[model samples]
Target: MVSSKLENEPTGKKLPRIEIRMLSFDLVERVEIARLLTDAGYSVRNELAANFDRFESRVMDDDWDVIFVDARVPYDSVSRALDLVRAIGSDVPVFALVDSHQENQADLMELGIADLFTSDDLQRLPGIITRGLEASDDRKIAIEARRLQNEIEFAGDERAVLAEIGRLVSSSLDIGQVYDQLVEQVKILIPLETAAIAVADVASDSVTIEYLSGRELPGFDRGRVMAMSGFTSINQLPQFVFVFDTELMEQMRTEFPGIRELLNAGVRSVMVAPLVHRDEVVGFFATGTSTENAYEPEHVAAVEQIAAQISGALANSRLHIHISRIARERETLIQIGRDAAAAHDLQSLYGSVFKNLKNLLPVDRGVIALKGEDGKSLAIEYVEGLDIEGLRVGDNLELLESSTAVLTGSQPVTVDNAANREPFDLTDGKLITAGLPSTMRTPLRARDSIVGLIAVSARDDRAFTQDHLSALERVSNQISPVIESLSLLNQVQSLAAAVETTLDLFAITDLQGVTSYLNPAGIRLIGLEEGASGVGVDLKDFMSPEQAEIVSSIGLAQASETGGWQTEISITPRNSERPIPVELLLVPVRNPSGGPGREVTTVNVFMRDLRDREALQVELREFVLTVSHELQTPLT
Candidate 1:
């Protein structure tokens, strides 16, 4: 049958469209029901239930907000149609329509009828439908509110976990302790069966596992160093890498073999966040689980937050370590200086140097070589560790590639593999033969000149780093001056010994005529005790008035201009009544690069006693006179 179409006209308020199905045997009653619902702002479809097929087809065709069945229809047909609605799992409220008060209201309710009404009460249908829909909307609102409350609580917990992690990171400079606490806090946020921190070593181009928790993976434990090339490049990774399944893990396995151990440890999923500081990736924070697809977007985000906090703390700890190391190196340098100053001999000085240098750098073998007198060869002053057949402490070694390079460049040189390079001298060949492959050498510079070289070696290749080279260079710079000063002191001591034993009087007087040093001979010539020091005596005290006047007027002036002056003088001896005649020479001692205008620092006085020579000459003349007088007497 063709259903009547009815449309609601526009009103002051918009109302929700409600669809209703009408069941009746009479076509007149169906049209009446459709008109009433249409006027009341509901869309309606009418179904005839003369037989079950017609009623079931209409009910299954559309989703209805309400189903209306008239009691005038055959009781059996209405009952069967209600049964059909219930069998289809439709929750549409069903209202039974009665023309007379003949049907039992209780029986209709038992059959799942929503309400009982007749043609007189047909007007109340719209109000009943409105209240039902309002009640349904209220239930939906309550469900959504509970879901939002649960989400808010979950977010609050996550924030609490992050705040605690931040607190842990800021609490200590000890990185290990902070990491341990950090992993525990992270476990609360993510379902982690394993967690680890790997630190990258930029100098060595390697990564080392610094901390591990949970299941231990073989060959990938803490302190294990692996080449950085064995893992995925940190720069290419996202903020956090999430290997959610075995498929993705397999895809990443080819480039990162380090993850294979995780798989073997029953870790099927993983999340990794790179620890970045100052825009550079320095390490990684990783978490894994035994269940595939265990990590969610929220878990990835949590790890990233933790990684950022850890990165800042790790950077601070590393900086602290670096500064402490520098402080220790400075202290080592100071100790080396003290050692050099207190050393009594060359051997003691070298021993002190080696002992102090070991604190700053690796020194399995140490050698100290100074330039020879000829300036063409280096004499080994000290050697440790290497034992060569012909190489000894006093052996002279020709300037070779390594030492020459250090001298010429005035910088440190490092040989990662000494055996791989061609030997330039016997010392280099001996080092290679001794199985020492790594070496660092720096020039020992003194007074703006390369005086020697200091070298250290190790048995392992690539054992020394640029920092070691720099440390050796600093040590060389300090040691060079001490060595030079010691050499000058030795020379001065030998010269003083010779002057002390000479018979000729040697005296050093300041420009003001005060004696600074009088050698033993000079002291004896002045009639002082053998062990007496003449350091505070005046030069004029032991000279005659005329000689003192000559020295004050002409001797000092001539020496200042011409570097030396000589004169015959008489010295009055303190222990004797007579005066001693002597030939005196005065020489001005000036700076090393002395010129005519340079100031004289002191005067060197050389005196030769003339009394003995004069006495000899007198005796010879007397003998000649006596012999001549005897001859004259005999001839007369």
Candidate 2:
């Protein structure tokens, strides 16, 4: 029967659940110890030697707080339990329940028992159990603290290794050579049976063994290409730690088939350190051994640190063939980010991105396209590479007809030789027509979705290398959010621009009588330049003394009513002493932003200049008079 929770016991959250494992041939002895531990608020488990197979499995799989054993039992002795625990490397403490203190005391003490109590001492069982649990908890804390300390030291070492690798990346030009040199340098720093570096091709979504050292892998060859399944390990391996036996290796086959293959070929242990580029798991730096228990946690950490440095060096090598631009690029990114952040509209934001991208790579033409409304089409948002007039903003193109198909497929696409590639296969058809040599397309990724596509073209054959592509990708990541923000800002600015340039004079005055906005026509009516200090001035400054008196008393009071206020009034300009007659319309602007009762910070005012209407009336009167008096006399 399965064990169930005790009714009187507290939940695991409030108190630690104690698990006691018993190993004894005598049924009476097992019952006594279990009942004693249970009465003391512990969860007890019985492991009678009547069925040794099930008993051994339970001891191995479950975490037992303390194993109480009949030390010299005929069928299942405490020595047998000790032998099993040592074989499996279990840390569970063993306590011996000896019959008497007289027989073979030296042999019993050598069994590595945690504590020994005479069988007659039932009174000491409670005290013995309590002390054992306290010691167990202390041991657990000490182990965890030791693990954390090792991690801290490992992190420090990784930083130093990364700094060294940074220097190597800064000075090196050849990526292959940098990786080869890194593998050699890692061997000197870390002990391993074999170490190899595998690099993933972004376009191919496949991995190839780039560098190899140590014991030559029997079946696996250098430059062997395989699917993404071969490269990715199931668990996010931190310590490159996998100890292979038959059962453990087989269970892991589905996630890491290639690693399993190595284990099957008489390999005992292995660890994988990922070669990451811009937070991406591009490939891995792997180390394996033929001897079991050969690698430790510290070794796992050491290899990972070396791999990280190699990854950074490899990524840096690709940026510029002969020139080191990481320092300059870092500064450019900071400045460009500052500039991009100020973009209140799409045009300026897109202009900044494309202009800065040219300094980063050889971008003869650039295209920023996005997924269309219907979900099946890709629409061009901005174009730069060639004269792509047909693929203008809002022009919807079929996803299959463009290189953007690969981007949405969740991988990058590159065309080294545009002449041999299909014209339609490329995102922009004009690339081939204009004799452009190479093109690369990558997804413009945002937080929750792939917002758009970014494609770049070059004029020279195979112009865009891995380093150029990485730089472009880095640029894409930096600008994706800015693009999204700018897109939203452009829509809002368009609406605001329409209101500002309208024929009527408009202004928003706050509750405190300060103007916040004076539109284009409002600025003209106020006789001030666009950038002048008209915005912070009071509404009374635009009205004559008499008009101001009427507004301060009658107009303002009437506007407070629910109907709002509208009447013709005389207005004064800042530059002129003369007052002008104009019709005024005022409406209260509500703040739906928060709070109660249509709370508003400003009132929107519209004033239509009456001068044009007044002139038209005069012209109509002159025409009527001339026809009635002058034309009647001319008829003779």
The most accurate candidate by lDDT is 1
lDDT of 2 by residue, 1-636 (tens): 012223344454332345545554366666776677668666665555444565578767765666666666652355676788777776666777666745765677787877676757765776677776678679979999999997887667666666666666566566666655555555544556787777666556666676777788865656555565563543443334334444555667777777667876777766677777677655677777776666666676676666666676665554453355676667667767877888776667677777887777788888888776555677788877576656677787676544445555323223423434533354454655576656777777776567777888776555555566777677778888888656655554554565455666666777645677767777778777657745686877777778777776777667756535777887787777877777776555555345456454456666777778765445433432332221111110
Candidate achieving the largest TM-score: 1
RMSD of 1: 17.9
Q: How close is candidate 1 to the true structure, as a TM-score?
A: 0.51
Q: In model 2, how many backbone clashes occur?
A: 4
Per-residue alpha-carbon lDDT of candidate 1 for residues 361-439, written as tens digits (9 for 90 to 100)? 7778888888877677888889876666656788988865464654554332224234445323336577657777567
Clash count, one per candidate: 0, 4
> Candidate 2: which pairs clash?
240-271, 318-467, 365-385, 366-385
**How does candidate 2 score on lDDT?**
0.64
